[model samples]
Target: MFKVVICDDERIIREGLKQIIPWGDYHFNTIYTAKDGVEALSLIQQHQPELVITDIRMPRKNGVDLLNDIAHLDCNVIILSSYDDFEYMKAGIQHHVLDYLLKPVDHAQLKLF
Candidate 1:
């Protein structure tokens, strides 16, 4: 079993994802949620989850910065953002992110990952 972390500034989004996703089905033993990149980074450093789903724009720290900080960690990333900016996409690519997902996420698309 693996662990996964979900990072977003919105409470509804964080909680909604936690409830909607079938973590057990995906072989995830634990799921952690963070309201911002600051908390997410701390969780990542401590727990070292196998997967991280993060938002691009966040308070305290942004996703791109978090990506840079966690580059040395052995974890896959899937960027989640409300913005469709190419710069953000480029950053994700540079960071070797597994995928870049948009806001109001599609459950089917997310499940495929």
Candidate 2:
């Protein structure tokens, strides 16, 4: 089963995702959630999850910075952003992020994994 780590500053978004995703159905067993990138990094180091889903504008080490810090690490990153901007998308692409999703995440799109 795949392990996944999810990070977002907003408690609601993080909680919503945890509640919404049917991880077992997607062959994922472990799901870790963090409120910020700093906390998320610790979990990432310990869990080394197969995938990471994070909000781009989080406080204290945003998603892009976290992605850069882990650029050499072997993990798939899926960035979630509220706005559609080239800067964020460009950075995500440069870091070889697996995918980017906008706010109010679409279940259909996520299921396509």
Candidate 3:
């Protein structure tokens, strides 16, 4: 079974994202969430989920920092951010992030994953 972890600072976005995906349909048995990068890193280490979707900016650690730590892992990475800055994309690129989603993420867009 595949596992997934989503990291974001906003409670609503976290909850909404959790609800948006039909994990069972995607063959995902476990879904986890973290409010900030600190907690996110801990979850990633503990669960080692196959997929990680993380926000670009958060209190503590930040996505770039987490990306640095997890870059060697086999899991797929997706970045979420409000910014369209090239530097953010560059950092994600350095870490092999597979996709980027703007805030207020569209469920359809995510479904494609």
Candidate 4:
């Protein structure tokens, strides 16, 4: 089964995602969470999940930094952000992020991704 990692600074958002995501529908079983990019990178190195869903504006190493650091890793990435700035989108695109979801992501849409 595939493994996934979810990273966000906000406890509520992170918990909500963990509870809401339809893990059964996807070919993944293991789901992990990290508070920030620092923790995320550590988790990535250890678990090497297939997918990573991360918030952009997190404390202690943002999503972009994590993405850059993990460029050599073989995995898909989805960015979650409250800001809809083109620059952030552009950065995600540059790193070949699988998708960029705005805050309050739709459950249906997230399942599809």
Best by TM-score: 1
Instruction: Tell me the tens digit of each residue's lDDT in model 3 across 17-66.
Output: 88978778888888899999999889989999989989989998898999
Prediction 3 TM-score vs. true: 0.94
Clash pairs, candidate 1, are none
Candidate 4, residues 32-65: lDDT per residue as tens digits?
9999999999999999999999999989999989
Candidate 2 structure, TM-score to reference: 0.94
Clashing pairs in 4: none
Summing lDDT over every window of 10 consecutive residues in candidate 1, give the lowest-scoring window: 104-113
lDDT of each: 0.91, 0.87, 0.86, 0.90
Models 1 onward score TM values of: 0.95, 0.94, 0.94, 0.95
Off by over 4 Å in 2: 111-113
Instruction: Write the residue-wise lDDT of candidate 1 on 33-112 in tens digits.
Output: 99999999999999999999999999999999999999999999999899999999999999999989898886566842
lDDT of 2 by residue, 8-112 (tens): 999988888888877888888888999999999999999898999999998899998899888888888999889688999999999988888998886666732
- Model 1 residue 30 lDDT? 91
- How many clashes (backbone N, Cα, C below 3 Å) per candidate? 0, 0, 0, 0
Q: Judged by lDDT relative to the true structure, which candidate is superior, 1 or 4? A: 1
CA RMSD of each candidate after superposition: 1.1, 1.2, 1.2, 1.1
Those runs of model 3 whose alpha carbons end farther than 4 Å from true positions after fitting are 111-113
